[model samples]
Target: MSSSLLIALILLLSLLAYWLGCRRAVTLAQRPSADKLHSRPGYYGVLAGLWCGLPALLIVAVWHLAADPLLTRMAMHGVAAAKGVASPDQVDLLVNDMRNLVAGNVVAHEVDPLIQAAADQYVGLQRLGDLALAAVALATALGGAYVLLGRIRPALRARNQVERIVEIVLTLCSTFAVFVTVGIVLSVLFESIRFFQQIAPADFLFGLKWSPQMAIRADQAGSSGSFGAIPVLTGTFLISGIAMAIAVPLGLMSAIYLSEYAGPRFRAVVKPLLEILAGVPTVVYGFFAALVVAPAIRDLGGLAGLSVASESALAAGLVMGIMIIPFVSSLSDDVINAVPQSLRDGSYGLGATKSETIKLVVLPAALPGIVGSILLAVSRAIGETMIVVMAAGLAANLTFNPLQAVTTVTVQIVTLLVGDQEFDSPKTLAAFALGMLLFVVTLALNVAALYVVRKYREEYE
Candidate 1:
């Protein structure tokens, strides 16, 4: 069972035990004052339940996360004391090799007998941790019940204890998400730093080329791939801008129509149709871009008397815009609906027409939420991979014209790490650097969006 589910089962069993104890107490004491006895008895049951369950569950969570890395560390130390591997790099290499062996992988060198033994020890230690934790949790829950049953007699303060336990349990659940997000950010931050060591920060930030080549064989072709991200970033920004141009007006208008204008029957049909865009696989969009959209864009450019590449930015951008329309519309609609109906009634009573009330009152009230949706859309556009990978040319063009071809950070990251390649090369490391940049950029977008939503929400309130 998942640790979470096991924890839940333990808590549930404690609750059941508390209920049985409380029911028995009530049956034994038949006094009228007993119905009023000790905060209605149910409170006593819950209090006992919380006392039995909460502490051990917290320990289990801490144990699960700490177990793997701790055992790995122990295994690393074991290997360090072994016969062959002595240096730091060698230790790291041995760890990786041992990991591969456990997964039934072929290692670089013939496997050392001692290192293999150490790998077995790590796995065994992890199993032991799991077994020990389960035992401890069961023991603690049973022990807690034994104590709480004694305290369940009349005159004990049970309701307050139950409430306090509820508060702590809720806080623990909420903190879990925050902890996971922080862990991910720290992991990415460290990996990115390792990558930046291979290529200078300034060079990566300012360089003009992006062909990351591993010079494995003699006389590898092409100028060493420019790791400079400006061009790809420009492409992402340009295409995302184009996408927003198409999506915002179209999606928002559709949202306004659906939420404010469309009848129930029409909405029932159209909302699903709009969301169907989201359900469509991006890879399918890629195919459509390559087969249908690219040619159509090229022809339109031809009619406009402008030279356009077969694989152009306009095609990818438009397709991406289509992909994101449902996201913006769905979010905007929910935010608009969340606005108070009394505010709308006041606007209408003041002789505001439907359009004017919606524009001036509802939109202003929902502005923060709308801006959040747009920021989310912008982030989605930036991180989008398959459509850009197939339709937009892989060449990183520094130009701004939407009619011409351009690449993006996500696409390049995909190409950089697509095949079998050495992890030590600048090419591979560059992917980490780009990923870090992408993460940072998205993090900023989300922060800005949330800030806008918070400020405006306060204004509305």
Candidate 2:
């Protein structure tokens, strides 16, 4: 049986087990001489279901993990016996062929009779394994239900058992998240170390030029690429700064207006419309930047007798700013509205104006959250690539002038890894280093934001 079908069957059995267990518990309670049940009837039902499902689920998991590699090994052994002394790559190809034949895909290479026989064996073994798995899992689940039902006395702590199982599952989920984060950090760190070994930290970190093209051979054209990352870093910050400049004030003002001045009906109509900007895809924004915004900016600059690159930081930054406005406005709106009503009432009773009260009492109270929102917006702006790629040109010019063409770390990382490139090359490795840098920058922003939040957080209670 398919795993999905088997799971559905197990679930149905568990439901039956739940009903029986509940009915038996109720019967025992109604008996003249029986003690009152230790826990609720629903707890008994849940305990029975856990017993029926958990063991069978474990069996399915183990079989699913182990069955594929085990069957592949056996199949590969058949191929090896038939075609003596093949390389590891050849063995893998033959194994793939066996799988393709079984799955009815067109085999890419010539198929031998021995390989065909092995493919047939693979199909037979897989079907047999799946059948055996279904049988064993269902039997285990049924047996567990039988045992648990027999043990379901009036004094059984079904509630405690169920709670313990839930606790373990939650703990596993939490630990898994931590492990995943640690794995990402370690993988990036290791790759970055390899990158830094090939290029000096001083050169990559501080040098002005940003060229990453390394000659494959000594005779190849172009100077063995400049690994200096300063230009990319500069462009990233310039665009992000421009974005934040446009986003923070406008977003904060919008939040203030929505929370303090706008009536409920107006707020309802406008807030969702404002937030619609956030839902727009980045690629759509990219197209807007490239097609509409860049041209407008260039025309404006030309009218003022200034040179503007077709793909300039100003165009990308403006679109990115528009994209991040909702994040700030929404977060700040919530934070501002969360201020205690009593604070505002007290300020009003003291003869303070609404504007004065907001500036003195409400804003100070919501400052931490506002700061957090801006930081989040800044981070979003920094990490944006599609708009930057489509709007800003990929020339890594180290300049802060918004009218000039520039590139970012993310853009360069994408550039470096676009085609079939050798992993060991400094060019490819540089992408990892840039990635690590971006990671560190984002981490630092989070840390700084946390520190600022804690420092400025106001306790109302």
Candidate 3:
């Protein structure tokens, strides 16, 4: 049976166990000589369900993890013996071909009689393993349910055991998440180190040119590629700066108006309308920027006798700012609303005007949250890929002029890793280096934002 079907059966058994446990608990509670139950009948039911499902799930997980590799190794050993020994790479290729054939996927090479027989053997082994797994898991679930039901009584600590088991599961999930994050960071860091070893760190970091094209052969034209990240980094900050300039004022003002000045009817009608921008896919925004905004900017620049690239930073930044406005406005509104009404009342008691109270009392109280929201908006802008790719041309120009074409770190990373390229090449590894740089920049921004929040955070009794 498939894992999903097996899991479904286990769950169905658990439900049956829960019903039986609950009925037994009720019967015991009604008995004349039975003492009061330590926990509720529902708790007993839940504990029985946990016992029924958890051990079965654990067996399924462990079985799959251990069985797949063991089966693959056994199949590969047969192929190696039949094929009269092969290199590790050749053996891996054969293994892949065998598995692909077994999975009904396209194989890179023609399947001979030997590989076909091996594929059949592998399939037979998998079926046998799945059958064994299903039998063991189902038996374990039934056994656990029987044992727990026999032990369930008035004095059983069902709720305590259930809570402890839940706590352990949550902790395991949290630890897994942390490990995944660390693994990603380490993978990127290692690849970046390899890239820097080939291309000088100083050159990659400080070079003005951003070409990453390297020739496959020594005699090919343009074999030397520049890996300077300066232009890309400049474009990133310039576009993000323009986006922030447009977003911060508009978003903060709209938030203030919605939270403080606008009446309930208008606020309710308008808030969702503004937030709708956030739900629009970035690709749609990209198309809008490319088709509508970019052309309009170019025309306006021409009318003003200024040169504007067809794809400029200003166009992308403007649309991105519009896209992220909801992030700023929604969070700021929530923060401002959370500011104590008592502070406003006290400010009014002191004869301060509404504007004065907002400026002196409410705004100060909510400044930390406002800062946090703006920081979030800034991060969103920096990390945006589609709008920048569509609106801003991938020229990687270092110019600060919004009218000029530019590219960001994310755009370059995408460009580098677009096709099937070998990771051993500096060209491909450059993506990881750029990724590491972007990660550092984002981390620094978060650190700065945290410092600002801590420095200005307020307390009130």
RMSD each, Å: 4.6, 2.6, 2.0
The count of residue-pair clashes in candidate 3 stands at: 0
lDDT (Cα, 0-100) at 70 in candidate 3: 89
* lDDT per residue (tens digit) for residues 237-276 in model 1: 9999999998899889998998889999999999999999
TM-score winner, 2 or 3: 3
Candidate 1 vs candidate 3: the lDDT winner is 3
lDDT of each: 0.83, 0.92, 0.93
Q: What is the lDDT of residue 395 in candidate 1?
A: 82
**Regions of model 1 farther than 4 Å from truth:** 1-15, 18-31, 35-49, 56-63, 66-84, 88-133, 153-159, 169-208, 214-225, 279-281, 295-307, 417-429, 432-461
Model 1 worst lDDT window (10 residues): 216-225
Candidate 3 lDDT (Cα, 0 to 1):
0.93
- Candidate 2: worst-modelled 10 consecutive residues by lDDT: 106-115
Instruction: Candidate 2: give the clashing pairs.
Output: none
Q: Can you give the TM-score per candidate against the true fold?
A: 0.77, 0.90, 0.94
List residue ranges in candidate 3 displaced over 4 A: 107-110
Better of 2 and 3 by lDDT: 3
For candidate 2, what is the lDDT?
Answer: 0.92
Top candidate by TM-score = 3
| Candidate number achieving the greatest lDDT relative to the actual structure | 3
